[model samples]
Target: MMNGHFDTDNPDKVIHKGEYENSFDNMREIALAPNTHKFVLNFWTEDLKIELERIRTLDITDNLTKIKYVCNVRPYYYFQFSDPDGNIIEVTGKYTPKEGQFV
Candidate 1:
């Protein structure tokens, strides 16, 4: 039986009972690679507005690049941009990433 908080019909929510430990143990000491990457802390609600100030596009590609605007509890927007490393940066928005996608 699953906890009432989750729908019992959902397979992802189904788990064998009594398998969880009272307190979880940390296994971080042995298996992870030595720290070489800088860590960034994301504060979900702490004035994240500035992070989506502008959308910058580079080395334009044929694939579709656009932001999906979602308005619910918060009016959030998405901005998609390509970096010099060819990595796509998706920033939550107040505006769309591509000019054509905007009004």
Candidate 2:
């Protein structure tokens, strides 16, 4: 189960425990850039801020630097970091999708 949503028999659909919002499952995998994949872990703005600050205080390798960027069309704030496996992990929040926006 993920985020209170359970995997359904339909590979493309996850059954949420309550009212569903803008969630989707793409059944097919697409080619990603070298050392990168489209796997993002989102968090609330406050939570992300706290977590990022905590990470900065850790005496970890310098490779785990944080990079911030914004998506103008949908308007979200996020930071990206590469894991040991080279998969891109994004800690994101503050999504301001326009009405009728298809995420």
Question: Each model's C-alpha lDDT?
Answer: 0.33, 0.41
Write down the TM-score for model 2.
Answer: 0.42
Compose the digit string of candidate 2's lDDT tens values, residues 20-97. 222222212212233224455544565555566666677442444342433223344455454566554456654443
lDDT at residue 101 of model 2 (Cα atoms):
37
**lDDT tens per residue, model 1, 1-103:** 1122232234353332212221111123211425311121222322223443322233353322343443333455543344444344444434334453432
Measured by TM-score, the strongest candidate is 2
lDDT of 1: 0.33
The weakest ten consecutive residues by lDDT in model 2 span: 18-27
Give candidate 2's whole-model lDDT. 0.41
Residue 33 displacement in candidate 1 (angstroms):
21
